[model samples]
Target chain A: MRRLKALIKKEFHQIVRDPSSVMIAFILPLILLFLFGYGVSLDANRIDIGIVMQDNSPQVQSLIRAFENTSFLNAQVERDRREIEKQLVAGKLRGMVVIPTDFTRRLINPDDTAKLQVIADGSEPNTANFVQNYIRQTWVNWLLQSGLSEAMLTVDERVSIQPRFWFNPELESSHFLLSGSIAIIMTLIGTLLTSLVISREWERGTMEAMMATPVNIIEIILGKLIPYFVLGMSSMVICTIISIVVFGVPFRGSFITLAAVSAIFLITALQQGLLISTVAKNQFLASQMAFISGFLPAFILSGFVFEIKSMPAFVQAITYIVPAKYFVSCLQTLFLAGDIYSVIIPNVIGIMILGSVLFIVITRKTRKRLI
Target chain B: MLNRIKNLVIKEFLAIWRDKKSRVILIVPPMLQLFIFSFAATLEVKNVPIAVFNRDTGRESWELVQRFEGSPYFTDIHYIYSDKAVKEYINSQKALMVIQINDDFSSRINSGQQAEIQLILDGRKTNVSQILAGYVNGIIDRYNRDIKPEAQVRRSSQNAIRKGKLTASPFLSPASRSEIVPRNWFNENLDYIWFTVPGIVGILTMLISLIITSLSVAREREFGTFDQLLVSPLESTEILIGKTVPAFIIGMLEGTFFIIAGIVFFNLPHEGSFLHLYFGMSVFLLAIIGIGLLISSVSKTQQQAILGAFAFMTPTIILSGYATPIENMPLWLQEFTVINPLKHFLIIIKGVLLKNVPFDVVLEHTIPIAVFAVISLSVSTRMFKQRLE
Candidate 1:
C-alpha cells in the first residue's frame, strides 16, 4: 500500500512537471470547447441567396421584400439570371431564386400557372435543402399576408402543426454540441495521457529500472491508472463547469451521477491507453495508435456530431464497440434530458464491460521481463 | 548541395520505411479511416425511429401514419396507445420523434375544421430534430394539399383577386398556383458520399502530413540526436528540405490514392480538371507541411509534438467548412478561416470534382494557400535555424 502511494505520488509529480500533459488536459480542451461552442455550428443561418428579379412588376417587389425580411436569408437582388448563376457555380450563393418574366402575368391571369424558379448549389445538400425550405416558407407567408389565400378558405380549415422540441426548446446546436464535446475531450485526455506512459518508460529505458524495484506489476498499473484517472476526472469536471456556467448549457443531472459515470469512462479510456502503450512500446507508435483508435472514433462514430443511426448498418454495428458512444449517450441525457436511469444504466454497463475487457488485456500484455 | 539534400531525403524515407510498424501505420489506418469515416460522417438523416399516438382511429389519421411509414427517412414506427408511452419512447431515445393525432383530428378534418397534430421531437439532437420536423411538415403539407386540391385552387384565385393585383376576368381558371421549381445544379442526386469522400481527401492528407512532419524533428530532439544532426555537413535548409520532401511525397500519395478511391470505389463524378486538382493539392500540402514543421520546431518532445499537432488539427478541421458550412459561422471566424489551408483545398477539390470549376477560380483559391505556404515555411525555417544555432 505504501509503495502504491509512492508510485501514485511520482506519477502526479511527473504530470505537474510536464507542461504538455497539463496543456492537453486544460488548454487543449479550452480551445476545442471554444471552437465547438462558437465556431462550429450545424445551424444554417444567414444563408447567402441571390434573388434574380427577371420581372420588374410591383407584385414581384413585395415577394422580394418578404425574402429580405427573414433573418434566415441574406438576399442579394440582381437583374440578370446568368450573372447570379455564375455566382452559384462559383459557390458564392447557396441558391438563386429567379422570378421569371411571366411571373406577374401568370399571377394576374388565372389561366396560367406561375412558377418561381429556385436553383440551388447541390454540392452541399444541407444548404440546398435549407434554401428550398426557406424559399417555400417565404412564398407561403407572402401568399397568406398578401390576402391572396384569404378568399379561398378560412385559417381554421388548414391543418396546424405544433412542433414541440422537448428538452432543448430553442434548438441551439451549441447546447448539444458542447455537451457531446465533453465525451470527446475526456476520450483524448484519457487515452493520449496514458498511451505514452508505459511507452515513454520503455523508450527511455526506465521500464527495466522500474521493474527491478520492489513494486509489482499490478502496483505499477494502479499507480499509472490512479493519477491519470484523477487528472481526466478533474478535466471532465472543468469541461462540465465551462459547459454549464460559460456556455449556459443546462446541467440537470446530479453532480454525483456525473462523476460516477465519468469515472467509469475514464477508467475505460485509461485502460485502453495502457493496453496500447504496453503493446506498442514506442511513444510515436503509441500516440499515433491512440489518436487513430481513440480520438477519431470518438469524434465520428460516437454520434457527437453525426447521427449513428443514419450511418450504414455495418458502420452502426462498429459503433457498438466505441466507448465514447455510450458516454455521449449518457452525456446528452444527463445534460439535456436529466437523470433517466433507463438511458444511463445500460450505457454505464457498456462502459464497465469494455473497461473490464481492457483491464484484462493490459494485465495479460504486461510482463516483468524485457523482450 | 543537391546531392546532400537528396541523401538526407532518402535517409528520412529509409528511417520511416525501415520500421515495419511505422510503414503499416502510415498506410493502413488511413485507408481504414477513409472507409469508416466516409460512411460514418454523414449529416443526412435516415432510418429515424419514431412513435405514433393515434387517438382519432380515423381513416385520415391512418393515412397520415401510412405516409410516415412510406417515407425512406423513417424506418421504425412504434404505435402507442397512451400518452405516457410517447414520453417513455423519447426519453429512452428509442424514438427520435412522436406523432400525436388528437381525438378530434379526423372529425375536425372531415368537418372542414382546422385540426391540430403535435410532433414531439427529442431536442437533444438539435439538428436532426429540426430536420425531422421539416420532413414531418412536408408530409403534413402534402396530405393537406392532396386531401384539399380544390381548396388549394380556390385559395390561389381568391388570393390574387383579393389583392387586386390582377384584373378580374370572367374566364378565371384554377391554374394560377405559383410553384417553386428547384434544381440542384452540380450534384443532381446530392449523394452524401460525394460530399464526404472529397472532404476526406483533404482531411487524410492533412492528418498524414501533419503527423509525419510534426513528429520528425521532435523525435530526433527527444532521442538526443538533434546535436548529431546539427554537427552534420548538411545545412539547416537542406535538413528542412529533407524533412519536407518525405512528408510531402507521402501526403501527395495518400491524397492521390483517396482521390482515385473516391472516383472508383464511391463512383464520385470527376467533373473538373485533374491539372487544377493536382495544382491545388500541391499548394495545400506545402501549407500543411509548413505548419507541421512549425509545430515540430517548437515542440521539445514527441508527446508535445503530438499534442501540438492535435491543437492545430482540431480547430483546422472544425473551421475548414468540412463537416459544416463556413458561412454559418460567425463573421470573425469566417474571416479567420481564410488562412486555413484545408478550407481553400476543400473548395478547390469539391469545385473541381463536382462543379467543373474554371482554372481561374482554381487559381483564385490556390493563391491564398500559396501565400500561407510561403509565410509558414519561412517562419518555421527561421525557427529551425534559431533552434540549431
Candidate 2:
C-alpha cells in the first residue's frame, strides 16, 4: 500500500512537472467542448432559399411573406427559373418555392385548384427535403386560414397543433453538441494520452529499467496512473465549464453526477489505452490503434454523426461495447433535461460495467508483463 | 540527375522492404483508417420514426398518411392520439416530428379550404428538423393533390405553359412529354452515401497513412538509427525516397480497396474512366507523401512530429469541403484551400463518382494537385541532408 501511494505520487509529479501536459490537461478539453457546442450543429438555421413568385395577389403576397419571416428560411429572389437552378447547383439555395399564376383566384374558385411548386436540389437530400417541406407547410397554413380552401367553406373542422419541444425548449444546439463533445474529448484524450505515455516508456527502454527496480509493479503502474487520473478530472472540469459558461450550454443536471460518471469513463478509457500501449510498444502503431478503437468509435458509433435509434438493429447492438454511447446519453440528460434519475441510472450502470471489465483486463495485462 | 533520382528511388524501396516494421507501417494505417472511418464519417440521417395524429380520418388525410408511409426516409409511423402523446414522443426522442392533424382537416378539404398539420420537432438534434418539415410539406402537397379539382386543372394548363411563357405550339405538343422525363445521369436516387463514401475514403486513408509515416520516421531519428543512415553511404534522395514510397503504396492500395468496396457494397455505380482516376490519384498521392516527408524532416522527434501532423491534418480536413462546403468559407480561407492537395483530389473524385463528368472538365482541379505534388517533392528532397542539423 505504501509503495502504491509512492507510485501514485511519482505519477502526480510527472504530470505537474510537465508544463505542456498541464496546459493540455487544463485547456484542451474546455476548448474542444466549446467548439463542439457552438460549431458542430446539425440543425441548420437561417437557410438560404430562392423564390420566384409569378402571382401578384394578396394571397400570394401573404404566403410569400410567411416564408420570408420563417426562421429556417433566408428568402432570396432569382430573376428566372434558370437562375434559381444555377444558384441551387452552386449551393446558394437549398431549395426554391415557386408560386404559380392565378394562385389566389384558383384557390377561391369552386373548381380552381391552388398550387405551390417546390423544386429541390437532391444533391444534399437532407437539407433540400427540409426546405421543400417547411415552405409548403407554411403555404398550406396560409391557404387554410385565408378562407381559400373549398373544404373549409363546407365543413366546421379545425385542428389545433400545439407544438411542444422536449428536452430542449429553446432549441439550443449547444445542449446536444456539448454533451457529445465531452464523450469525444474524453475518448480522444483519455485513450490517446495514456497510450503514448506507456508506449514511450517501452520504446525508450524505461519499462525494462522500471521493472528491474525493487519497487512493486502495481506501485510503478499506480504512480504512472495517478497523474493521468488528476489530469483527466481537470480536463472534464474544463470541458464542463467551457460548455456551460463559454458556449452557453445548459447544465440542468447535478455536477456531482456528471463527475461520478466521468470518473468511471476516464478509468475505462485510460485502461483501454494502457492495454493497447503495453501490447504495441510503438508510438505510431499505438496512436493508430488508439485512433481506430477510441476516437473513431467516440466520433461515429457514440451517436455523434448519426442517430443510433435510426441505425439498423445489428449496428445498434454493436454500440453496446462503446462506453461513449452511455456517456453521451448521460451528458444530454445533464445538459438538456437536467438530471432525470430514470434516464441516468441505466447509463451509470452501463459505464461502471465497462470500467470494471476494462480495469480487470488492463490489470491482468500489466501483471503479465511484470511477471 | 534523372539517373541519380532513379537509383535513390530504388535504394529507398530496398531499404523499406528490409524492415518488417516499415512494411507493417505501410499496410496497417490506411486499412485501419478506411475500416474505421467508413463506419464513422456519415452525414445522412437514416430511419426517422414519425408519429402521425390523424384527426381528419377522411380520404385526403388517409392519402397524406399514405405518402409518409411510402417514403423509405421514414422508418416507422406510429398513430399518436393526443397532444400529450406528442409531448411524450419528443421528450423520449422516440420521434423527431409529430405530424398533428387539426380536428377540422376533412371538413376544410371538402370546402376547398387549406388544412394545416403542425410539425412539433424535438429540435434537440437540429440537423434533422428541417428534413422532417420537408417531408410533412410533401405529404400535404399530396393531400392537396388528391382533394383539389383546381390542382388537376392547373396541371393541364401547365402542360400548355413552358418556362412561365405560353407559346402557341398546338401543332407539336408531342415534345412536352420528354420534358417530364429527367433520367438522372450518375445516381438516379442520388443516395447521400454515394456522394460521401469515395471522398471520405480518400481523406481518411490519407490522414492515417501520412500521419503514421511522418511520426515513424521522426521516431527513428529521435531514437537514433538516423546516425546510422548518415554513415551508411545512402544518398539524400535515396533516403527520402526510401521513407516515402512504402507509405505511398500503402495509401494507394487502401484507397483502391475502398473504391472497389464503394462500388460493390454501397451500390455506387462508377461512370468515370479507371485510367483517369489512377492518373489523378497518383498525382494526389505524391503530393500528400511529400507533405508527410516535409513534416518528418522539420520535426524534432516522434511526439512533436505527430502533434504537428495533427495540426496540419485538422485544418486540411476542415478546409477540404468535407464537413462544411469550402465555397461558404471566407475569401481568405477559401484562397488558403487552393494550396491543399486534398481539396483538389476530393473535387476530382466527387466529379468522377458523383457527377460522372468528362475528365477534361475536372482537369482544372486535377492540375493543382499535380502542381502541389511537384512543389512538396522538390522542397522535401532539397531539404534532405545526411545529418540532423
Candidate 3:
C-alpha cells in the first residue's frame, strides 16, 4: 500500500510538472468547447439571391418586394443578366430570380403563365435545395396575398400532416454537437495523453528502471490509470459546464448516470492508449497509432459527424467496435433527453464490456519485464 | 551556404527513410484517409426507414405508399396498424419518420373534400428530418397534381389532339401555372463526391505537412540532437530549409496523390490550368509548414508539438469551409478566418478545379495565401533563430 501510494504521488508529480499534459487536460476543453459551440453550424439562412427584373410594373415590383421581406433571403437587384451570372459563378450569389420581361403582361391577362425562373448554384446541393424551397415558399405567399390562388386556397382538399419533432423541437444542432464534442474531447484527453506519457517513459529508459523495482504490473497500471482517470473526469466536468452554461445545451439526464457512463468511457479510452504504448514502445509510433486509432475513428465512425445508419453495411459493422459510438449515444441522450433507461442501459453496458476487455488485454500486455 | 543546405536536406531525407515503418506510415495513412473519408464523409441521406400507418385501403392511398417505396431515399417502409405502433417505432429509432394516413384520405379525394395525413419525424437528427420533410412534400405535391381536375381535363384534350380528333384550342386557360425552372451551375447533378475531392486535397495537404514538420525539430530536441545540428557549421536558415523542404516535398507528394485519386477514381473536374493549381498548392504548403515549424521551435518535446498542432488543426479545418461554408459562420468568426491559409487554399483549389476560373481569378485567391505564407515563414525563421541563441 505504501509503495502504491508513492507511485500514485509520483504519477501526479509527473502530470503536474509536465505543462503539456496539464494544458491538454484543462485548456484543450476550453478551445474545443468554444470551437464546437460557435464555429460549426449546419443551418443555411440569409441566402444571397440576385434578382434580375426586366419589367418595372407594380405587380412585378411587389413580387420582388415580397422576396426581400423574407428573413431567409437577401435580394440584390442587378440590371444586367451577365453581371448576375458572374456573381452566381463566383459564389457571391447563391441563386438568381429572373422576373421575365412579360411577367406583368402575363399576370394581368391571366391567359399566359407568368414564369419566374429560379437558377441555383448547384455546386453545393444542400444550399441549392434550401434556396429553391425558400423562393417557392415566398412565391406561394405572394400568390395568396395577390388573390390569384383564391380558388386553389378554397379547395383545401388534401392530407394534413402534422410533423412533431420529438427530442429536439427546434432542431438546434448545437445541443447534440456539444454533447458529441464531449465524447471527442474526452477521447483525446484520455488516449493521447496516456499514450504519450507511457511511451515517453519507454523512450527515456525509465520504464526499464521501474521494472527492476518491487513494483508489480498491476500497481504500475493503477498508478498510471488513476491520475488520468481524474484528469479525464475533470475535462468531462468542464465540458459539461461549458455545454450547459455557455452553449445553452440542456442537461436533461441525471448527473449520476452521466458520471458513471463517462467513467466507463474514460477507462476504455485510457486502456486503449496503454495497449498502444505497450505494443509500440516508441513515443512517435505510439502517438501516431493513438491518433489513427483514437482520433479518426472517434471523429468519423462514432456517429458524431456522420450517421452510422447512413453508412454502408460493412462500415456500419465497423462502427460497433468504436467505443466512442456507445458514448456518443449515451452522452447525446443524457444531454438532450432525460434518463431513458433503454438507451442509457444498453450503451453503458457496451462501454463497460469494451472497457473490461481492454483492461484485461492491457493487464496481460503489462508484464514485469520491459518490452 | 547552398551546398550546406543541400547536404542537410539529404540528411533529413535519410533520417526518415532509414525507418521502414515510418516510411510506410508516411505513404499509407494519407491514401487510406483519402478513400475512407471520401466515402464516409457524405451529406447524402439514403435508405431512411419510415413507418406508414395507412388506414385508408383506397387506390390513391396505396399509390401514395407506393411512391415512397419507389424512391431511392426511402426504404424499409414498415406498415404499422395503430398510432401506438408508430410511436414505439419512432421512440426506439427503428423508424426515423411515421406517415399516418387518415381513414378518409381516398374518400375525401373522391368527393373533392379535404383530407389530412400526419408525418411524425424524430427531430433529434434535424438535418435528416428537414431533408425527409422536403422529400415527403414533393411526393404529396405530385400526388395532388395527378388528381387535379384541371390537369385531368388538359390531359383528355391533349389525348384528343394527339389522335387528330380536334384542332388546337383557340381559348387559352386563365389558370395556367407559372413554372420555376431551376438550373444548377458548375455542378449540374450536385454530386457530393465532386464537391468533396478538391476540399479534401487542401485539407489532407495541410494536415500531412503540419504533422511532419511540427514533429521534425521537436523530435530532435526531445532526443537532444537539436544541439548537435545547432553546433554544426549549418546556419539557422540552412537548418530551417533542411527541415521544411522534406515536409514540403511530402505535402506536395500527398497533394499529387489526392489529385490523381480525385481525377481517376472520383472524376474530379480539372477546369483550370494545372500550373496554377500546383503553384497555389506549393504556397499553401509553405504557410502550413511555417505554422508547423513555429510549433516545433516553441515546444521542447514532440508531444507538445503534436498537441499544439492538434489545437491549431481543429479550428482551421472546421473554419476552412471544407465541411461547412465560411459565410454561414458568424460575422466575427468569418472575419477571423481571413488569416486562415487553409480557407484561402480551399477557395483557390475548389474554384480552379470546378469553376473553369481564369488565372486572374485564381490569383486573386492566391494573393492572400502568399501573404500568409510569407508572414508565417518569416515569423517562424525568427523564432528558430531566437531558439538557437
Best by lDDT: 1
Q: Candidate 3: misplaced stretches above 4 Å?
A: A102-114, A155-157, A360-371, B55-60, B150-175
Write down the lDDT of every candidate, Cα atoms only. Answer: 0.88, 0.68, 0.81
Name the lDDT value of residue B115 in candidate 2: 68
Interface RMSD of candidate 1, in Å, is 2.5
Per-residue error for B337 in candidate 2, Å, reads: 4.7
TM-score of chain A of each: 0.96, 0.87, 0.93
Span of 10 residues, lowest total lDDT, candidate 2 chain A: A152-161
Better of 1 and 3 by TM-score: 1
Using DockQ, give the best candidate's number.
Answer: 1
Which scores higher on lDDT, 2 or 3?
A: 3
Expressed as tens digits, the lDDT of each residue in B1-389 for candidate 3 is 98999899898889888988678777787777777767666667777788899999998789889998998788778989987898688766678889888888889877766678888887666677777888888887666655667644465446545655424452222246455777777788888787777877888888878988998898899888999999999888889999999999988988998898899998888887789889889989998998999898899888899888988998998888777777677889989998888888887787778877677766777888889889889999999899787
Model 2, which residues run further than 4 Å from truth?
A12-39, A43-123, A127-162, A169-175, B1-41, B46-120, B140-185, B324-340, B358-361, B367-389
DockQ category of candidate 3: acceptable
Q: Ranking by DockQ, best first? A: 1, 3, 2
Q: Provide i-RMS per model in Å.
A: 2.5, 7.7, 4.9
User: Residue-wise lDDT of candidate 1 within B177-214, one digit each (tens)?
Assistant: 56678788888877888889999888999999999999
Q: What is candidate 1's lDDT per residue for A1-371, written digit by digit as tens?
A: 99999999999899889899899889999998999998879988788999999898888999999999998898999998888888887898999999999998987665667888888888998888888888878887787676544433443246889999999999999999999999999999888889887789989989889989988888988999998988888888899989999999999888899999999999899888988888788888998899999999999999989999899999999999999999999999999999999999999999999998887766666753433
